[model samples]
Target: MVPEFFTQTNGRGDGEQTLAPDSSFSNLEEAEKALQELAQVFPQPHSFISGIGLDFATNEVSKAAVPPEAPLLNMEAKYRALVEQIPAVVFMAYLDQGIGEAYVSPQIETALGFSQSEWLEDPVRWYQQIHPDDKMRWSVEAAEMFLSGKPLRSSYRVMARDGRVLWFQCEAKMIRRADGSPWFIHGVGFDVTERKALEEAILEISAREQRRIAQDLHDGLGQHLTGIAFMSKVLEEKLSDKSLPEAEEAAKIVKMVNQAIENTRQLARGLHPVAAEPLGLFSALKKWASEVEGLFHIGCSFQCENPFPIHDVNLATHLYRIAQEAVNNAIRHGKSRNIVIGLSGKNGAGLLAIQDDGDGILKKQASQPGVGLSIMNYRADMVGGSLKVQANEGRGITVSCMFPIRSPE
Candidate 1:
């Protein structure tokens, strides 16, 4: 609040002139007249001007006080400090195009060699740095998240400023208004390059072991079983020639040995080489679906309305294994009676969807995925694809993998 007058003090005229203590006027006109009269006696340059701050609301002299926005400003500072000090790259941006609040942490410079200012300066810089191979799926998934208000959790490669390819496990959720409109997105991206490398090493070792066991079952155990069956049949014929009841016992031994051989072959097939089929993933999946139906006694079907060749062997392997795992999960965990596997490739991308007719995965279970689900997700990521497990509300679950059909020649 402004006071009526600011008095000049510590300067006197030719004699000792004393000023009145409470000579302030109520109106500015009276105060101006008194100030002009006083200025004539004591020249302005010789005196110091001073005034006491008055607080009329309190009816007392004004004292230092906190502004209304102080607490909120303090909380903002605290939260900003917390976010900046975290290990991962933290970001906040509006879910919509209109930028209400935008922030990128300092760790971005350490992680990707880009300063916080540089990242936030351009709105699309984050998307631009995504690995070229992963951009399309990211765009599609991001759009879905925006429209459906679902949280985004994914892992993909990003190109850093130093030309290094880094894998990141990114997770984000949308903040909404009271009316349920999206306000902003708070996200964190952790550098998982080392973790991904470790996971790949483990999967490779596991695959090698599986192939070794499959080879042994197919060649070593299967040949031994075949020999036993052949010898038992010879014994059964000899016993029959001798006109003895032992021929029936020998016939049972032959039957058991043959069954063992068939079981060994089935085990070997389940272990490996389905991915190495000549007709690529389509025929492999079709044959696998038939095998699943015959073996498990479940109704399984394969669909390929539009089919194309998958030239890349590793890609075929990944796709085949993904379908295999999805089907296995349906039979084992879901207890599904019917399963549908769909394959389609056109343009440069395709989808492999496996749907089951059983109890869908519970939401609680999905949050903590099992080992098979984890492996399936990893396989899809290795192939530059995204895997989505959608529950059909007590009907069943659908596991879909979206992947780019093109790979290096």
Candidate 2:
């Protein structure tokens, strides 16, 4: 020991140590004597050794000054908890360059038939499960939106882990870093297959009702009117007598009956005409052109290749009514000298074009209400079709409609 002393309030010598001439305590007796004297002087919490020197110091150890942090909950546990509570599938991933590792909720098993682990390590495994025919196009669109730094909302088809196809609506947002770089994205999706199916079912039911009504008008009411006409003719023949004044009255009644029959027949044709079939769409179009031209004395022309089949009764009825409305509008409002009707079909689609060389629709636009246009649009919508009304190049109005050939059923 070199020196030992206690610095207390009084500053008195509370301890003392002996320094050997050789600076070493090799003998057990000398070490024991020095240790016994050091013990009486050294303070509590302080230590002394026989062989150690005063210059020999222990290295300082430092502990971190940071406060303790709370333990983090496992991501899988947190994810499962969230998914069980929400109706949608919640997903998290790093998607800046492309989709990185991610976690899909366990709900994925029920919604998409994919296990949670299958989608975690490979985020794009979701895309691989998408319907093959739609994947390429859907991916292109999604990637385009992502690169443009826009959020994505889309509906796509996915093949479930159970080998079933399902539809989903995905809504996602990107997370940007402090420097405006994309870091990741979070998304939620829900199954929309049931909703879509319900909508389709409602449409089919509506179409079925429309067809039934059309048939009733064609078969039931039409036959009764025909019977009335025949009976009226028989009564006229049995009452043939120049001497009888009631014979002239009976003749008048028969004439009236014939007119009523003709009118009823026209009404039946308007309702659902059998002629619509034999002539096909173009034939019906020609018949319509002739009747309207004869009625209004406005020259009408019909042309176009039979680009579509006229087998669908509902479609034929829709096209016929659309044409009927167009012609009536042209005669009453269009005030055009010539009207042209064109019908064509190709590639599983049908087209109906009507153009009139009239005063155009400028006058109607300013003064008359556009109820006709609205009605046309509504009728087109009823059949899952589109209607376009525009001014002709020269001086007329053109109304065009394109309808899908397949029935909703």
Candidate 3:
């Protein structure tokens, strides 16, 4: 078999789409020669050979894009040095028990206060360092990568050796041998603690401002508008009793004032969905579903067959925003006609899911999610939950967020 290499990057979480082969080589020497030439094509050494492979049947080159495991360390000193100095923590792992880390860059110490030797010494260090709340989701997502041979993009918090919590945005791809068996995992993790802090600050500030505005709309403007409507209705009645022509204008003013009050109330609800009590989330969602059906001409329903108490207001708010964003995406992007919002909790675990019947997602678009989806993910992450977006069987998209059920002490 001719040793050939394909130039394909598993990206956008849509690895099922096939990539057309770029170029091929007739022999090992030819493939090696092409590797040297690839430096000019891709300036980054790691990216130049991230998913490369060759078949040995006829000694001809098969695919020729990125570098795989064996050739990585075999490269020139300059190339290896370039990889070690990158801003992120680069790593390679064997597909053995514990998914042992085979190689890690020096950046690990800088990011997590652990030297490379210490990290590599123990096979279970990686698993042990994960934050307790994040371990379950990490294992689930990692399993998806192993099973599908697709790239994994996940962000979660991990504990440093110093006992400080840091956020990491980890992305990894599984490389397979020519015989289709798993070889090793090549990945990178970037420390995002500062960025996460900034995001939290911004979201908190925005949430506080929203709560203020919602309160003004609900208590201040709503009361004022109610007074106006009452006065207008009284004037209309008095003018009608006096058989005056101005009664028609008074009735119109009363109708407009009432409509304004309803609009303001809806806006306030949108801004601050969760209330003082935990069960407020359930009532808010039900009301919003009715609003969506009326305003968007769609069929929207909220389901809470078994809702347990969630005493944390922040948790309730986060869940509400997740559902709101998912439904908006369904209506705006997916062009959905029917939407269902489901909330369930049992045995100290909770789930929020939104399913919609719409145009669903195109394979290409599925990889490139918009801003709304990205924020929804972060919103879920804020409350120690995981968000998943998947296309429905025939037509539509489903957004699900799962978390543990807990109340603040």
Candidate 1 segments whose C-alpha is farther than 4 A from its true place: 1-68, 96-101, 277-280, 296-298, 308-322, 328-337, 346-349, 358-386, 391-396, 403-406
**What does candidate 2's lDDT look like per residue over 1-409, in tens digits?**
2333222233345553344333377786675555455555565213443222221123222222211331133455575676767888888787555434665677887787667876776656877887654454455546755787767665656788778877677778778899988788788988877875665577567656655676675577767767776776666667764355666777787777667666755765655543436346667777878887787777988988655456665557667778878878887877878888898765555668898888777764846548777777666654445677778788888898766556333
lDDT of 3 by residue, 1-409 (tens): 1123544546768654433445566776775666655544555634534445433334345555434655655575667689898999999987754534488999999888999999998878999998776676777778888887779877777899889989888889999889998988889999888988888788788888999999999999999999999999999999999999999999999999999999999799778888868688888789889989999999999999976778876778888888988898899988999999999976555789999999987877777878888898888877767788887898898899977566456
Q: Which stretches of candidate 3 lie over 4 Å from their true place?
A: 1-80, 96-101, 294-298, 308-315, 332-337, 345-350, 367-386, 402-409
Clashes of 1: 0
Per-model tally of clashing residue pairs: 0, 3, 19
Tell me, by lDDT, which candidate is best: 3
TM match of model 1 to true structure: 0.73
The root-mean-square deviation over C-alpha atoms between each candidate and the true structure, in angstroms, is 13.8, 21.0, 13.4
lDDT of 1: 0.80
